[model samples]
Target: MDQQMFCFQCEQTAGCAGCTGKKGVCGKSEKTARLQDELTGALIGLARATNGGTLYTDDTWKIFIEGLFTTVTNVNFHDDTIRELMGRVHEDKEKLAPMCSGCGAPCGKTGDYDLSRLWHADEDIRSLKSLILFGIRGMAAYAYHAMVLGYTDEELNRFFCKALFAVGEDWSMEELLPIVMEVGKYNLACMELLDQANTETFGAPVPTEVPLTVEKGPFIVISGHDLLDLKLLLEQTEGKGINVYTHGEMLPAHGYPELKKYPHLKGNFGTAWQNQKKEFAGIPAPVLFTTNCLMPPAGSYADRVFTTEVVSYPEIVHIGSDKDFTPVIEKALALGGYTEDQPFAGINGGRTVTTGFGHDAVLGLADRIVEAVKAGDIRHFFLVGGCDGARPGRNYYTEFVKQTPEDAVVLTLACGKYRFNDLDLGTIGGLPRLMDIGQCNDAFSAIKIATALADAFGCGVNELPLSMVLSWYEQKAVCILLTLLYLGITDIRLGPTLPAFISPNVLSYLVEHYHIAPVSTPEEDLKALLHEGE
Candidate 1:
C-alpha cells in the first residue's frame, strides 16, 4: 500500500503502528496531517529564531504553545486554520530574525526544519525524539490552559523552547534522552501551575455529584479541559434561560466552587469524547469544544458543532477571541433542547457520577486513609485513569474496576473514568471506593496524594501498596506516564497497546529499568499486584 503520510502518536494508530493512509483513524485527512507537520516545522523554526538572541515575549510564548497544541491529535482538522497558524509562526520568526530574510545567502539557523527528515530518521532516534516531541506537545496543552487563566511560569515557558530546539537538532540518543526526561521534569511544573490556576481561580474543588439528566430547556454542551471557557460560558448564559452542561473532561468543572455556583451550569451531558458522534446526533443544543478529544463531526450534528480555542474543524462556527458565545446561546435557544427531561446514564447505567477528588480533598482524608490501611480496613489502592478511546480492549478498564475488591479504593481522573464511574462501588473507611482526581492535568494531584501518603506511612511511593493500571490514548497520557517514570515510580501497567512510536530497544530499556508492562487481564494482573510483596 502506498503511504500518504505517517503518524503514530496515539495508542490506536493503525495496526498498533503508524497511520499511513489517506485518513488517520481519528478521521484527519492526509492534507491535514501535512499541514500539522508544516506547523510543527514552523514552530521549530520560530524556536530557533527566538533562541538566536531574540527576546521571548508573552506573545511569543503564546504562539509557540498554540502551534504545538494545534497539532495534537483530534484538536484542529482544518487545513486553512493550520496554515494560518503556520503563517503566524512564520511572521513571528520574521520579526525575531528580520535580517535573515534579506540576507543574500541565508543560513539554515533560523530556517524552518523539514519534518520529513525527523519522520524518516533511524528507529531508535525517532522513538527518543518522539518521546521529547509528544511529551512537549502534551505539556503544551497544560501550559496553554494555565496561560489562559492568567498564570505563567517562566521556567515552563523556557523549557518549551528548549524542548523544541532539541527536536530539530542532530543529537544522539544519549543527548536526546536527557531532554526527554527533562520534558517530564518540566511537565510536572506545568501541571502544578495549571492546578494552582484552576484551584485559585475557581476555588478548591469539592467532591460534587453531577447528574446525567439534561433538563427540559434550552442548553449548551461544553467539552474539553478548559475551565476558563466553561466559566465564561456559564457567566454569559446565567439568567438567560439557557442551561450549560459539561461533557468529557469538563465533568470535573462541576466540582469547582465558582462554576458550581451557577445554578444553570446543570449536569454532565454525555460520557467520554469518543462517544460524541453517536451521543451528539440530533441533539438540540449546540456543542462547544475548547480542546482536544474532538472527533470529526457526523452530519447530523455538524451544524450544531462550535469550536473555540485551538480546537477547530472545517466549516464549523468558531467563537473567536472576543469569547462571545452568542452564537452558541442563540443556537441553544433555537433548538429548544428536549421536550421532556432526558434521562442519560453513565456506561454502567447509573444516573450520576462524582468528581473533584483533587489532592486537597484526598489529603484531607489522608490520616483516615492511613489509619484504615494500618487497621486492615483498606486492602489496596489503584490509580486507574487516562484518556478514553473507541478501542476494543478498553473493556479491560471497565472489568478491572468491576473486579476490584471491596476493600480496595479506586482513584481515577481524565476521561477514562466514564468506563465504570457510575457503578455503585460503595464506600471503604468513609471514602467512596471510587475517587475522581479531576482532569488529566490533575495527575499532579494524584502525585501529591501519593507523596503525602508515603510520608505518613514512612516509605517510598513504590513501597506503598498502590498499583497504577493506566489506559493511554493520546499524547497527554504520554507526558503523564513520563512524569511517573521521572518520579522513579515503577511497576505501572499500561495497555490497550503500547505506543506505536516506541522502538523495541526503547521498550526493553523501559522494561529493564522501570518494570513497566503491558496489561494482561483483570484477574491475572490483580493477583500479581495484590500479592507482589507477600
Candidate 2:
C-alpha cells in the first residue's frame, strides 16, 4: 500500500498501527499530518539552535509550546493554520541563528530536521525517541497553561529544547533511555508548576456539585483544560444574562472557588471529548475548545464551534492571543439557548456529577482517611483515569470502576472520569467513594495524596494499597504515564491498549523494571488487585 503519511501518537490509530491513509483516525488530513511533521522538525531545529542553552526569552518558549501542542491528537486539523505556524517556527529558528550561511563560526549546526528519519530509523531508537517527543508535547501543554498565569519554570523551558534536540541526535537506547525517563521527571515538575498556578489563581477546588442540565437562556460550553479562560469568560458574561457551562476536561473548573463564585457559571453540557459530536448535536449553544482532544466538528453545530490557543479547525472562529472571548459570547447570545431547563444525564443516566475533590479537599480530611484505611472502612484505592477516546476497549475502565469493591475508592482525573463519574458508589466514612481530582495536570494532587498516605503509613507508594489503572490516548497521558514510572510506582495497569510506539525491548524493560501490565478483564483485574493488596 502506498501511504501518504504515518501517525500513531493516539489510541485510535487505524488498525493498531500508524494512520496511513488520506486521513488519520481522528480525522486529521494527510496534508495536516505532513505539516505537523514539518512543524515538529522546525521546533527541533529551533531547539538545536539553542545548543542546549537556557537563556532564551518567554517568547521563544511560547512559540515552542504552541508548536508542540499544535501536533497533539485532535488539537489542530487545519493544514493551512499548521503551515502558517510552521512559518512562525522557521522565523524563531532564524532569530536563534540569523546567519548560518555566512557566520564566522561555521558550525553547520542549526538547521530544520526532517522527522521522517526518526520514523524510518531503528525500532528501539524510534521507540525511545517517540516516547521523549510525545512526553514533552504533553508537558508543554501543562507548562503553557501555567505560563499564561505568570508562572514559568526556567528548567522546564530549557528541558523542552534539550529533549527536542535529543530527538534529532544520533543517540543509542542507553543514551536516549535516560532522556526518556527525565522527560517523566520534568513532566512531574511541569504538572506541579501548573497545579500551583491553577490553585493560586482559582482558589483551590472545593467539592461542588455540577449539574448536568442546561439551564434556560443562552450558554457557552467551555471545553478543554483552561481555567484562566473560564475565569475571564465568567467575568465578561457576568451580567450579560448568558450562562457558561463546562464540558470535557473543563468540567472540573466548576469546583474552583473563584470560578464557582460566579452565579452565572452554570453546569456542564456534555460527556468526554469523544462524545462531543453526539452530545453537542443541535444543542442551542456555542462551544469553545481551548486545547487538545478536539474532534472535528460535524456540520450541524460546526458553525458554533470556536477555538482558542493552539487549537483550531477550518472555518471555526479563531480567538487570538488577546484572549478576548467576545466572538464566543456573541455566538452564544445569538443562539438564544433553551427557554427551560433541559435535563441531560450521563451515559449511566445519572443527572448530576460531582467534582472539586482536589488535593486540598482530600488532604484536608487526611486524618479521617488514614483512620478509615486503618479501620478497614477503605480497603483499597484505585485511580482509574486518563484521556478518553472512542476505542471499544475503553469500556474496560467503566466496567472496572463499576466492579470495584465498595470498600475501595476511585480517584479519577482528566476526561476519563466521565466514564463512571456519575455512578454513585456511596461513601466510605464521610468521604465520597469517587473523588474527582482536577485536570490531568492535577495528577500532582493524586501524587501528593498518595505520598502523604505512604508517609503516614511509613511505606513507599508502591507498598500502599493503591493501584493506578490508567487509560492513555494522547501525549498528555504519555507524560503522566512517564511520571508514574519515574516515581518508581509499580504494578500500574494500563489500557485500552499499549502504545504502538513501545518496542518489544522497551516493553520488556518496563515490565521487568516496573512490573507494568496491560489491563485484563475488569473482574479478574479487580479481584487480583484486591487480593494482592491483602
Output the TM-score of candidate 2.
Answer: 0.97
lDDT of 1 by residue, 261-318 (tens): 9999889988999999999996899999999889999988999999999999989999
Write down the TM-score of every candidate. 0.98, 0.97
Using TM-score as the measure, the top candidate is 1
**Residue 331 CA displacement from its true place in model 1, Å:** 0.7
The clash tally of candidate 1 reads: 0
Q: What's the lDDT for candidate 2?
A: 0.88
Instruction: Tell me model 1's lDDT, rounded to 2 decimals.
Output: 0.90
Q: After TM-score superposition, what is the CA distance of residue 49 in candidate 1 from its true location, in Å?
A: 1.5
RMSD of 2: 1.7
Please report, as a residue range, the 10-residue window in candidate 1 with the lowest summed lDDT: 50-59
